[model samples]
Target: MRRIPILVTLLLVAACSQESERTYTVDELIADEALLSRTISDCRNNPGELRNTVNCHNAEAADGKLRLQNMRKALGG
Candidate 1:
């Protein structure tokens, strides 16, 4: 009986600890270039683990948007 209670408590603690972290939106990442760059670097460095994560997706989107904007500026558009 005591062992069962301890196991349940451990499971609860584990579940709380494993809660998903808040992910950044693409616009938010774009507005913060340093954060956007860091996120992209992290995702690229660990593609197997982060390729499908929300933050990675947002970071990639932000990067693409920034590149497009830069290209337009370079062409005087």
Candidate 2:
């Protein structure tokens, strides 16, 4: 009998805790700027060699830009 109420409460809690896409604050996004710079620098440094790594770094840089853009938009900037 008690299990039924406990289960219902747990389900309700879980449902309430479910989250959509996570949003970052402007300060949090800005903190990643250095990481983005490093990713860009890594790609630029190894232009011809390690094609896979260059591609990975390029992707990271692009993602970082998008994140910053989204953060700015969220912040009404």
TM-score of each: 0.76, 0.33
lDDT of each: 0.93, 0.63
lDDT of 2 by residue, 1-77 (tens): 99999999999999999595333343443566665455556656886763466344454656667777899999999
Error of 1 at 31 (Å): 0.3
lDDT of 1 by residue, 1-77 (tens): 89999999999999889668679999999999999999999999999999999999999889999999999999999
Q: Look at candidate 2 and tell me the lDDT of residue 74.
A: 100
Q: Identify the leading candidate in terms of TM-score.
A: 1
Q: Judged by lDDT against the true structure, how good is candidate 1?
A: 0.93
Best candidate, lDDT: 1
Q: In candidate 2, residue 35 scores what lDDT?
A: 55
Residue 69 in model 1: lDDT: 98
The TM-score measured for candidate 1 stands at 0.76
